[model samples]
Target: MPTPASPQRRIGVLLVNLGTPDSPQTPDVRRYLNEFLTDGRVIDMPAAVRYPLFQGLVVPLRAPKSAKIYQQLWTERGSPLLYHGLDLQKLVQEKLGKDYVVAFGMRYQNPSIEKALDELRAAAVDRIIVLPLFPQYAAASTGSVQEKVMDIVSKWWVVPSISFISTFTDDPGFIGTFVTLGKAEMAKREYDHVVFSYHGIPERHVLKGSHNNYCKLGTCCNSYNKNNRYCYRAQCYETSRQLAAGLGLAPEQYTTSFQSRLQSRLRDPWLQPYTDEVLKEMPAKGIKNVLTFSPAFVADCLETTIEVGLEFKEMFEEAGGEHWQLVPSLNSHPQWVEGVVNMIHRN
Candidate 1:
């Protein structure tokens, strides 16, 4: 145990997300990106290689461009990602009530995990459920959260009983939240094809966790199984499959693609067909109007708002498509709040 305990007991929950910049300014963006990119679970390279490359090259080169995109995503309420997470925390806390205390932290920026954990500890919480707000269990997302929480809590002299909600990508309530949202959006706009766009991770990350080369990154990831249980790509496909099934979409009517890949050669073999590439090709394939879903993210942020919702929309327009609409993310919707409440109760 890392900290001495007074034996006062209570129950608590901590919600975590990928995080956002403290502001849309360049320096703040640099701080957030530097911390995010330097995580081993994210880069998966040795310090000798990762720190210099990230600090010297990646952060300096990308922070300005990223800061600009974040500026576009900023709201009167501040960062959408942070505000959404904060609201979700409040909603869940209210739902849980006197029985459980809830706090939220970001993996990289403000509302740090340490502070959230400290809140739980200060409340004398003896049992905690750590919910990483990612639907899928990618090492870079859920794994990174799990690792950071442990590294922080492991130092306490009286460590609490902690259970991490690694992934809820397949949970009915989770799938249902998106399904409900997706169906509503579809009713508003008709498109030539529906595309499920997930955040792209390097193929090597998936292969590393997949047991014994079980994932070939082909049709093998088309479904979920014990073999590809931790395979992020497979799980993304699974999310798409279940959502499509719920929306009464035929497999042929929709396609799944990866988006927001870092093109630096180090991130080679990112999950593909890339969303932008897919957009460019779809127009030529007798498809024009498009509807897109980004289930990998629960909140609408720079990636979902600008990258897919704006940038890809432009790409489709340039490719001679008439319309390209994005389904808004599951951010603090009544259904999503309910789904999260259910997850806590179940946990």
Candidate 2:
């Protein structure tokens, strides 16, 4: 049998998210985008090709408009994504008690990974559990986080034991909390259809994740199997399946789609049907009123609050759809809070 952990072993828990702009201004947004997009996992291009794209094109053109969106998403306390993460950190810390030191940080900008790591190191933690706030595994999200953390910690004078939670695709408590939240929303109104819209990665991201031709971009991903278990696309579909089964949804009652694709030089197709395109055509298929669930994001951020909640609402309204209901993300909800506590304990 394995040796039991020491009684004096102090633990540090770091909760992480994608990130937010330091401020909701053009320059701030530009700076944030410059750092975020330049990550190799995010852009996935060599420095020779990636440098010009963000500096000359992406950041310069998108910053101003993206700033306006952040302005709308900003709260009196600060960005919703940042504040919600703080709340979650506090809640989980309280539940875990005095032995554990819990801190929240963003992959980019303020409360950065460097700051969070420094906090843990100063505390003289015996071991660290780094949990990326994403439910599903994607290299651009979880992989980027793991790589960044290790790179920083490797230089520490005295490195301690480290653990990382890459994904929670099949955790019972994790899936159950979402089902509870979704059912509560569905009871308030009857919807014509429900859509599980996940953030889109470049199609090559999915193909690169597949093992031995596991992902055929066909019905193959519709079911979960060992070959495709690590695949991001497959895990997303599995989340949708579990929630749909819990809610007693019929096979035809819901569908999966992807959102936030970039216009890159490569013609590689992102996942389909695209959420924006699908929303426009949903009304024509006799499904006027709809509800959307963005499971990829735990906290309602730019993509969830503005992109799906507000922007897509406008699109559906313009298309003559009667209703566009967006299920709020699981941001420090009580059940979700407890569930996260359980997840930390599992490690």
lDDT score, residue 150, model 2? 95
Q: Model 2, range 151-246, lDDT digits (tens) per residue?
A: 999998899899998898867767787788889889998999999999998878889888997788778887887888878888989999998898
Q: Write the per-residue lDDT of candidate 1 for residues 212-286, one digit (tens) a residue.
A: 889888999877988888889889999999998998999999999999877653537888888888899888898
Residue ranges of candidate 1 with Cα displaced over 4 Å: 1-9, 264-267
Pairs that collide, model 2: none
Candidate 2 CA-lDDT value = 0.90
* Superposition TM-score, candidate 2 onto the true structure: 0.96
- Candidate 2 residue 25 Cα shift, in angstroms, is 0.5
Could you tell me the TM-score of candidate 1?
0.95
**Colliding residue pairs in candidate 1:** 1-157, 2-155, 2-156, 2-157, 3-156, 3-157, 3-158
